[model samples]
Target: MAARHSRKLLRPLLYTSAAAAAGAGVLYISYRPRNIPGLEAPAVPPPGYREGKLVPPSFPSIKSRLEQIQDLKRSNDEEEYDLLIIGGGATGAGIALDAATRGLKVAVVERDDFSSGTSSKSTKLVHGGVRYLEKAVWELDYNQ
Candidate 1:
């Protein structure tokens, strides 16, 4: 009679243990790390830290650069700029560069500092125009 009672009690325990073990197995399998092929670390270092070569950033590093920047600021404060760029964004900087290259004096003034706005955000993309690339390809002759 006791053996019969013990067997009945043991049956539920065994089923519970088996179910728990199966759940744990499923969890382990589901959460296991999968092996992906062809994924690799970057081969090239990012700009400014080029392939173990250290490049110092421009700032108050030297006295002459500081003096030059101060002189430019003073000049901007005193007189009107020929090409006054309001922002230090890519567009403004590019315009300034283009104007200066064409022999026009340019001055860029930013409320914050150069590249302190959305220009400094890493989430933004800087890509060559897709249409320009397509046009160049279209113009190319395969025979050449």
Candidate 2:
């Protein structure tokens, strides 16, 4: 008898919870920033990317996002890209950026989260690449 009463109560609670969820969904859809005046929608680029800077994507967690990406790679047959980079280190990322800027179909695959590898592992000073640079040349490096 108590189980029956509990089940009866649960049915209403579940229905109410679902209704609340649907209402929240509708509220979210109706309250988007793009629906407001003088607001621009978010930018999404071709082949699953945002056309923008070097910043890591905003996510709940970098590790979780990377795991999701790995799942996608395992499940989906990706498009044939002109450039496929294997890491998110500085050199790999630079190559990806260069190819993308040149209007090529570039996709970079980082094994770990962005900057989790040799890119940030360097102990050298930031400007150590081109040492003793000529002032007039507009190129400076300390490694020269």
lDDT of 2 by residue, 53-110 (tens): 4555454334567575675576545555677788777776766765766657776776
Q: Can you write out model 1's per-residue Cα lDDT over 16-94, one digit (the tens) per residue?
A: 9999999999999999867533244333434487679987554434345457468676884556567877877776666
lDDT of each: 0.66, 0.64
Worst 10 residues of 2 by lDDT: 123-132
Model 1 poorest 10 in a row by lDDT: 122-131
Q: lDDT at 133 for candidate 1?
A: 56
TM-score against native, each model: 0.33, 0.34
Provide the clashing-pair count of each candidate structure: 0, 6
Candidate 1: TM-score? 0.33
Reference-based lDDT, residue 17, model 2: 100
